[model samples]
Target: MSAFMTKTLKALGLAAVAATLAVSAPAMASGGAAHPHAPKEGFSFEGPFGTFDQGQLQRGYKVFREVCSNCHSATLLSFRNLGQKGGPFYDEKYKNPNDNPYVKQIASEFEVPDIDTDTGDAITRPASTSDHFPKKFANEYAARASNGGALPPDLSVITKARHGGARYIYSLLTGFKNPPKGLHVAEGQHYNPYMAGALATQWSGDPHHVPVGGVLAMAPPLKDDLVTYDDGTKATTHQMAADVAAFLEWAGDPHATLRKKTGVAVLIYLLLFAGLTYAAYRKVWHGKH
Candidate 1:
């Protein structure tokens, strides 16, 4: 190889090594426990042609409402959003989600803090399509106090915010296991192979073989038959986890279907335009060659 190419390859190798160190620094500094990669899931919205399953999204919404909503707040969500095109509750008759009857009913189920207009006294009124999902606690401090000093994260964009998106959530929810023989789990802490934290101090195992997972305060939230689906689909723990993850994915990227469709249309248009351009060029210079 030429001297220039040899130098370039060496520089690349050094850069890659540096990057590896940088990424591993946190895990090394903590407990030498790297976060395990979540196994890939077969989502309905997986590929270029994949579209979301509306029924699954609806079931996911139910799971969130019945369970996750109690702790994690989806403050960015509004009832109207649930009825928008591609949403779980979308209806052909209701182009304006605000006017969607199903959305209106769901909104009414929650009471939101408000003030009496005449007296200015604090009161609460039934929520409307315009209101965002209410906070689970009055404030952040309250949220922490209620949950053993661990602040539940806002799940509005959780799928996008976390690595591996929906797959990570599914794995974490189902990945809880009994701590290994030498691992010491503290009060309020649960061992989850998918959660990230330092386990070196809690581990009494071989120094070189610290556990592959970390501890989390939140316990596994799903159980078999914990939720009764309106559509009568069996609510296994795995099913609920998958459903909720899919719902959160849709909530985070409600326009994904549209975006994918638009990309396909653009590709088709470009292909047709190329063929037409070739035909036009041939016709214009039929005998010139």
Candidate 2:
């Protein structure tokens, strides 16, 4: 072949490679956009990665409050109750460990509340809304009792006051299934299609069909032998689900305590802006007539 022809063919090959890269770039960047089982930050649940281990939750909380909190607010959580059951928002458990300064700082900031058994009241002053997050469940029975068969969700801030919110959150959490057998999952990553690519576990057909992992992820976090409660109540998978769901529900709705204040502030701002706009309009037209 002539040198000119060879150069032309090389250019064409380069263009083809570029085109192919462009087509695959978005897919590579977004591993799990098409599937429902994608894990999103703050929204995804880590299941096969592991169930709701209290110790793990503590670490997760550290990750959330330290890293994720800059963009996302757990406005549903209170600053006071971080150490208690609902979330690992506190760090006292690792006070003795010299390696965990993050845990030590969180634990040092506040005191944990003890519950009163005799009258069924909090033995200590409740953590004020500004202090930290509240316990997800006052107890297991309490967690189950809230939802009318559906688990009562916490709304410290993020709940579906409008359309599609609940479904979006639910789908992201439970969407991880078995990636087609023997698929490799990277460390610190959970299996999810909505966030990851199509693993062997995700099959086509019915979107509503539960993935191979389980039906609704909200169902089982605590199973027999999974978690041990101090109160002697078996921390069954259902109970863990109920507890974490309740805790998340609380995290999503923490602003309930300040809803009135926020509403009033918004009302005042709107009224003032409206008045200013009206006055400005009148001034502009005042010279017309």
Candidate 3:
């Protein structure tokens, strides 16, 4: 079998096992108490509690670059945009030395087509086109082949698309504990309740879940300690999970901060306008009363 097919079958087998296990997990045998894992209510990704954590966002960028970028592509992002206040795309001087080589190599491999101003001939290099990012896999077929019959979905908008978005991501990263003693994830699948349709070998479809920076299925590409922060934040797994979640949240909504700012301004303006109108009415009514 081709390596890709072999991996796919393995993943499918695991998925079957996980599905059975998930189905059999004795549906909370009671109305007495809520299961800790029960779905949360009002889980919208808005409001103050779910607000983007800047510190976490910065760390998340470190995790993404250090661990998650191996098979996944942040083609939607740019090296230059890291300059935004809470963006993970920090400037060169602030980046860790170890991550530089691989990041640069990957960025350089993308072919960017450009017109030579003098000759006007189109040329391609390690960059993207208006319609496409550099191919992370040799082709789309190769990407699908590598995972179970599924292609690794582009992560650019994953945080935004998933049901829980931020919490779901954070939980998945820290969720890969040893499945209950009797429960072994079948050969091909991974053991995750959150990834409803995940392949066995495709834990969260990316390898950033291991105790280290990344996981074993794809190897821990971003091992702990790979990055040291000038801000003195200890690079723990939890911190990494939180930061990357924040960064991806930003990636999913680059204008989130701006939108919040605008919302506050609009609210303030309405309040001021209301106050002035009320005062004007009172002044006119004073003599009438």
Model 2 local distance difference test score: 0.42
Compare the candidates by lDDT and give the number of the best one: 1
> For residues 54-82, could you state the per-residue lDDT of candidate 1 as single tens digits?
99999999999999998898988888889
Candidate 1 lDDT trough over 10 residues, lowest sum: 23-32
Candidate 3 structure quality by residue, lDDT tens digits, 1-289: 3365456556655654564454223233122111223123322224532345555566677677667765677667664344444444434564442244434544565565568888989876564212234446767788867765455667788865665566656556655544433333554444444444423243333344321211223322334566786578887665666567667768877766666666556555655665565576667766673
- TM for candidate 3 is 0.58
lDDT per residue as tens, model 2, 188-248: 3355544424544535445554333222223212234454554455544433333444344
RMSD of each: 8.0, 20.2, 17.3
Off by over 4 Å in 2: 1-30, 33-79, 82-173, 181-191, 194-246, 249-264, 279-289
Q: With candidate 2 superimposed using the best TM-score fit, by how many Å does residue 49's alpha carbon deviate from the native?
A: 34
Sort every candidate by lDDT, greatest first.
1, 3, 2
Q: TM-score-based ranking, best first?
A: 1, 3, 2
Which candidate gets the maximum TM-score versus the true structure?
Answer: 1
